[model samples]
Target: MPQRRRNNRVAVSGATGFIGRALSNFLESNGYEVIRLKRQHFKSKKSQLRTLLKGCSVVINLAGAPIAARKWTPNYKKEILNSRINTTGVLVDAIKEMEPKPELFISASAVGIYDSYEVHDEFSTSYATDFLGTVCQAWEAEACKVQRIKDVRLCIVRLGVVLGNEGGAFPKMLRPFKLGLGAKLGDGHQVFPYIHLNDVLNAFWYIIQHETSSGIYNLVAPQMLSNLEITEAIKQRTKKSILPVIPEKILRMLLGEGANALLIGQKVVPDRLEKDGFTFEFPTIEAVLDDLIC
Candidate 1:
């Protein structure tokens, strides 16, 4: 573990979401003051989001609609885009309105910001027309506006699939595997870029304390494994058999265009985070599964 830095007051949006809740608790446990931004109520509008953020030195923006919570209906897609973009826009406006703006702004992004079919690093070119890609592009663009505020440090984290025991992909995957119904998807060739929940919490702390860190960093473990490899590992851990594989066409027919993004693979590595001296607690798929399963 790295040496702890000076404590600072931090404000977080989406404090109720999976990562948001975990990060808020982690920061509070580590002696940092955490303020949560909640939605406005008509009766007592005095609790404005800007007011809640007052005097905070760092702002961690994690507020966004859950992408996998629902089927990709057109209306839901609009809401998804609006939720991220609007929340970010509001945060930017609030910061601008603050008398003493936060010193550092750590915003959330997704690896989806890059082309889905190809691997991407911090310096990768933008490929913004795809569904998830466009959402991430807009979200990051909104966060970049904070740089215009003098003396403010802005960093964006492109997170991979977060694996945890609680509300995340892990639990859903675990259910089927535990029931002995688990199987690989779409030839099981798609890459699964993942990070342990503990590592993710530590990464946020590390970035917040390290003043020199800025720009986009991929918040993923060093290891990138294909879906088949992950399923096989899970089977080994659970003593289950590998069932029939779901073909890509079937998944596409069932999940629409978004299915391709899940079925296809990308071999992303966290080159920037590694160069920045951050170490992952679970750097391999087998290690991660062992921790999560057992």
Candidate 2:
């Protein structure tokens, strides 16, 4: 697969998702043709999918169930794991049958792959043993199958808490702050590894532009911040005073295991990305909130 053979055409599996929609627009603005691979496309015959994938230079797999969508019942736990593993499996199987597989296959993972106990880089093996960590591990493992496909390079991005205005965690947090109900989660000591949505779009384009880029990359900002700091940043923008901490017990009770997504987070940094010369547009919580709230 020669570089630029496809004329910058790309296929994305989770086009309807928050990140996916943002990424698609970014790609198109950069003069690349974007193909939205909806859920139905994954369910259809592989031959049909192969048709859609024709001439695509890259295939991005961002298709996964939202980790914090609901309380994690035992069945819902299965839903999280299956949504990631199954969709990646289906996409990989289809790519294998292609006469000329895409030049690159990029998959989405999360910082939750690491346990809350340690600061991690891309090489750390300190994996989390909890359900969220387990799902993230399995998600990357399934995505790794793309490595076996000849001519297809795999790039896995372990994302941090994404902050943006269009959609995602920021908008949800904004409503409470606007209502003067903003409060820190748990003890507010947990590190909130976060990145802006614009940087995410640029990172994908960076991977596409850097043909040699492959393997796992921790997609986070250079600055490390605590949940309390993020709350303070938001408060500065919304002119809301801080409320008392929301006890961990209360979140756990409401979200069950799902509260871990908010109450617990890893201190992850973008070591590999910076080492590769990729720079973030918004590197701190202050910058992120300024862009979204101002």
Provide C-alpha RMSD values for all models, in order.
Answer: 2.4, 1.8
The candidate that wins on TM-score is: 2
Instruction: Give the Å shift of residue 111 in candidate 2.
Output: 0.5
Tens digits of per-residue lDDT, candidate 1, 143-194, equal 9998888888999999988999978788988788887888899878778888
In angstroms, the error of model 1 at 230 is 1.0
For model 1, the superposed segments whose C-alpha errors exceed 4 Å read 1-7, 41-47, 126-128
* Candidate 2 lowest-lDDT run of ten: 1-10
Clashing pairs in 2: none
* Number of clashing pairs per prediction, in order: 0, 0
Candidate 2 lDDT by residue in tens digits, 151-259: 8989999999887888888888888889888899999999999999999988988888888899999999999989998888888889987688888998899889899
